[model samples]
Target: MSRSKWTNIIFLIVILLLIIPQTRLPIQVALHKLITKVNSIRVLEEDNSVRITDTNWQLKSEKGLLKNLNQSEGKVIVINFWATWCAPCIAEMPSLQSLYDAYNNKVDFLFITTDDFKKVSYFKNKNEYSFPVYQPYSQPPNVLMTKSIPRTVVINAEGEIVIDESGAVDWFSEKVQSELNKLLK
Candidate 1:
């Protein structure tokens, strides 16, 4: 096909996708998930291979209580930024849950929400998601704060951002397990 013809075909598809919102969203979401999975595997590396200075980010307390974001200081830490109302976030929770179940003993998983406390609690209960949930008590480190979510950040024992991306990802994939296993070692 000629380059001009291909460009016009692509433009028409995009226009149609925009005109009919429902048709394109699912395809876009599927593409995002696939890209996330593929890129995650391509970039997987051992924890010891990377390091960064301590961010020293603390979670805000609720009812005079605080969370131990630092508890897994010497272990793999997976923090997911999500909200109850976010469809993509909800769609990816099951995979996150599976990932947590497999590595709960070796890695720390935190599902940090920026939604109302009651809503989060109810959503968690309703969904039967068991990962520890919290909202930022104060402003998080700049690296953690972003305009878009469900951004997931993986920090190794040495505190490096192993994988930082914004999209719904399949956390329980075998390749992901292979990568996390290296971090645990």
Candidate 2:
């Protein structure tokens, strides 16, 4: 082959090498499978500690008294702090709702929204979600002052803050259910 033809062939080969991985369905599937496997392995190696604290704080729920959270004695209270703008928060809400339905009487599922009361009302009205929605004023209650959406604070029946994590977590996970069961007992 002439030098120019050879160069053109090499360029085409390089382009194919780069484009094939992105364009090929099998390659994408394999990559997704690998990622899933890696994530599962990491989760298996995670610690199972239920982080809790005695921090005294309050939050403003549309339902009035913040003390209502304290009233759910002897029940597992899953306090999920989220906002409408957060995609993960919106994604995990349905799962949270399902979990709530499963344990409605056994657990107190409080879905707290940190967005403006107007926005929260609009979103809740639009979605027709029956979960208790709350909005903290300019100065949120101490318990919810963290200002981080998608933070879930699991509290035991005794009103003690259990697992306080700042991210979207699978509320219906076996691990979480198991922990809640322990507290219920």
Candidate 3:
């Protein structure tokens, strides 16, 4: 074969390598970690009644129901918006699960998704994720109705939006965990 044909073959391989999921996921994750910076700051402890997290949620399974954020007042709350079809969401889920595992007892982790129950269930079971997933029984606070997927809003015990990120985040990062710990204190 000519050198041009060999070059064309190599180009096609490179394109296919980038197009395939298994080959592309790691590259995307690396790029995200390189560009996404987590800021460290103490969350305000001031009292506020904004309550954008004032929505009711039903557990994805038959486990139970979350009354409302009002009932969860005085507790550190994590409300994450994700979808089963989102690649970045899927990529970040393991870290979310790790965060859940570490703080599940101390934090109210609500993995809220607007996707259908069937799709959510399939995704959960396929991935074997232990984190609690829910569908909103009522609309979330206006601050959360975002156009982006994998949005995360961390409400300190004082009901402040301490960390409101629009894209996938490394929830188990040291800085994020420190902020969460500060909220508990």
lDDT by candidate, in order shown: 0.74, 0.62, 0.74
TM-score of each: 0.72, 0.59, 0.75
The candidate, 1 or 2, that scores higher on lDDT is 1
The CA root-mean-square deviation of candidate 2, after full C-alpha superposition on the true structure, stands at 8.9
Task: Write one digit per residue (lDDT tens) for candidate 2, span 69-138.
Answer: 4345566777787887765566566657767777888887777765787887787788766677755434
TM-score of 2: 0.59
User: Which pairs clash in model 3?
Assistant: none
Writing each residue's lDDT as its tens digit, candidate 3 over 20-120 gives: 98887666656556544452223434453344445443344325455565766788999888988776787678778889999999999888887887787
Which residue pairs clash in candidate 2? Answer: none
Q: What is the lDDT, from 0 to 100, of the residue 156 in candidate 2?
A: 66
Ranking by TM-score: 3, 1, 2
Worst 10 residues of 2 by lDDT: 37-46
Residues 45-143, candidate 1: write the lDDT tens digits: 564334545456666432436765665577788889988766567667888999988889888887788688778778778979777777787667666
Shift of residue 16 alpha carbon in model 2, Å: 24
Better of 1 and 3 by TM-score: 3
The best-first sequence of candidates by lDDT reads 1, 3, 2
Question: Looking at model 2, how many pairs of residues clash?
Answer: 0
